[model samples]
Target: MLDAAVFQGLSWNLLDDFRQLFTYPFMVNALEAGTIVAVMAGVTGWFMVLRRQAFAGHTLSVIAFPGAAAAGWAGVPLALGYFGFCGAGALVLAAIAGTRRSLGAESAAIGSLQALALALGFVFVSLSHSILTGLDSLLFGTFLGITRSQVLVLLVVAVATVAVTAFAARPLFFASVDSDVARASGVPVRLLGLGFLLVLGLSVAETSQITGALLVFALLVTPAATAHRLTPRPWLGLTLAVALALAVTWAGLALAYFSIYPVGFYVTSLSFGVYVLVRIVTR
Candidate 1:
């Protein structure tokens, strides 16, 4: 027979579990940080996906690894390296591509940069040697160690990013959908493209701290992709993307809290699953 006692001892309760979610200080901080990152990722990722710059975003994400590693090696705040390197990477990519006509060259440049970033990450690891102890967290993520200050920083960045994105949304949309037409109609396509890339870099850097270098796309790309698949309207898609991101982050945190698995796995799995389901239904 089945183990009736085991089932009885489980005693699952939704309300109880929900209450326990924020009982701990660490959990509180993590929840706060995660919410900010989720919102920022959703807003920024919408433009990123629409602009077809996922490859560039991925490169910025990978760059976060070496950035943090280099900081560890130099005994500095990891955030500085994250922002600095990612911003630099964005500038480099923007410079290399310049305009839409250079997309083929942009792809080549992005690929080369991605390769270099991966290699530099390993170089930093080797240089740090025994000091870079958070490699697993750097690659995969662990929200347990997030502090109140980190949460605050994330909140500030999220607000600024959302505001800027909102301000630029109309022109950005025009340029993204039809750059040639937008430029012909006085849209400042090149400036918008460069500005958007910088924002994408910042978003990737911020999100990488939460989702880690390897799984940034889980929060940044998948929800946006799923929302786009399900909705045709830009405003609705953006809202849905943010909501889906929050849902994924909350669910992933809850599941991870009650299980032995890492949060990244849950987050990535949920994101991928939703994307697949949306793709199927949309098709």
Candidate 2:
């Protein structure tokens, strides 16, 4: 009879597969992009979770999906369309729903935009008369086929994201943790809020390419949530979040290379599992 764990596709022979992970250039690229995406998502997501903007982040991802699908239909890079549409959506949200009191309205607007984008994606798919494999993969990423060009783009975006987040860290944190005090202290809380949203839009765009727009929320939320449970200090939480994200991405990649499932599936599951473990351990 087959070994029970082997039947489930888990193996101690993953070390052999680890060597194979770097044998192919494409796999190398995937690992690079995935690492960047994980770090950015983890860092930014920490603030998002703390500020209770998970719903907004989810909305951004959903809205980006149709743009990506449309790009595929038009025979262009999915990143271009996803970033444009999501950036627009974010700006619109900020303009129409600028204050804490208007959060409900912002959510409603995001929902409407998500529906509209999905409908457009379907229309584009029908018009193109093409296979939906790419679109489906974008919705639920398959890490095995990542290309060199995409990897380069991911690196550029990751670097830019790090820079923007670093520059905005002080005021962003001040506003996020205590907006009233920040504003009273002469912080431009309104601009800071909009700035954070814009950065979040970029993060969502970059991650959606790797994890699919739908699953991006997993990476963005899980690491940050887990880190928050372990630390109350903002800087420590951010650092821990980044570390946890790196661990999840690396672990997931290793598991996927040795297993039968997609990398996105393994990564997301591992992240959630880590969060649960952290919570239990802390408790």
Per-prediction TM-score to the true structure, in the order listed:
0.93, 0.90
Candidate 1, residue 84: the lDDT equals 87
**Reference-based TM-score, model 1:** 0.93
lDDT of 1 by residue, 108-151 (tens): 87898889998998898888876544788788877766878878
Model 2, range 213-243, lDDT digits (tens) per residue? 7888778998999999998998899999988
Q: After TM-score superposition, what is the CA distance of residue 2 in candidate 1 from its true location, in Å?
A: 34
Taking every candidate in turn, the Cα RMSD to the unseen true structure, in Å, is: 4.7, 4.2
Candidate 1 deviant stretches above 4 angstroms: 1-11, 99-102, 131-133
Candidate 1, after superposition: displacement of residue 193 in Å?
0.8
Q: What's model 1's overall lDDT?
A: 0.84
Model 1 weakest lDDT span, ten residues long: 1-10
